[model samples]
Target: MARAILLRQLTLGPRSRLQLERKLRDRNVPMEVAAALLDRFEDVGLVDDAEFARMWVRGRGEAKSLGRSALRRELNEKGITGDLAEEALEELTPDAEEESARRLLARRVRPFDRTDPAARDKELRRLVGLLARKGHSPGSAFRLAAQVIDADSGDNVLEQRPY
Candidate 1:
């Protein structure tokens, strides 16, 4: 019974043990049975939260251009915890976010015109909002968009302030 439930859930996608446990309990599976089944699944390599977290972060981050901060939040919400999440996040560092952002900008930067105030305002807001939804901070998203805009236009729309 426990295996049936677990397999059903996994057929949808990988799930952390905690998330599975919650769902199993909600379905009225015995706690002891659920725990034993989870242990068995782990011992046999059928369930691995660490691997799940890693793959989840990589796929979502790359596809959606999410930053580390956003990815971490997603991992936590999905029932991944502690060192597993941290290590997976660390492994994703070293330009993954920048690469994702570059890919996103490459696909969507053509229509924005930095010279027109109203058009620039609308474009900047749209870009910032889109990037923010993907987990980039407002400041980081703005800076990255500015980089793309300047590179394409030969003039910096967001000139750096004197430090």
Candidate 2:
């Protein structure tokens, strides 16, 4: 029965071992039964935390434009931890993160012209908040926001300031 439940869950989507175990516990499956079933699943490659972490990181990073810190928090929430989580996060380079941040800012700030100080400042604050919530450092967010604004305006008018 435990095996059936686990297989049914996996048929829907991949699940971390911890998630699977929690599901089994929620269903009142005995601890020993859950352990044995999970061990079997692991042996058969049906429950692989590392691979789950990797896929999670890739999918979330691309879909959400999240940085390493955000990715780490997500993995932790999914019960991925320690070296496995770190290994998955390694797939996203700092350059890639920076580029994603720039793209996000560009798309969001396109409406506000950089020539207008009031509008630009308001837009910058909003963009920086977006980036910060996505786990980007304030400094990097400010620098990238300024770069995008300057490039769009065709003038290096926006100076990089500490956020």
Model 2: residues with Cα > 4 Å off, grouped in runs: 153-163
lDDT of 2 by residue, 30-124 (tens): 99999988998999999999999999988888778898889999899889999999999999888778867766765676566556899878877
Clashing pairs for model 1 are none
CA RMSD per model (angstroms): 5.0, 4.6
lDDT for each residue of candidate 1 in 2-119, tens digit (9 for 90 to 100): 7898999999988888899998999999999999999999999888999999998889888787888889999999888789999888877646676677668656775655678888
Q: Tell me the deviation in Å of residue 130 in model 2.
A: 0.3
Q: How many clashing pairs does model 1 include? A: 0
Position 109, candidate 1: lDDT: 70
Best-performing candidate as measured by TM-score: 2
The lDDT of each candidate is: 0.79, 0.83
Q: Estimate each model's TM-score.
A: 0.83, 0.88
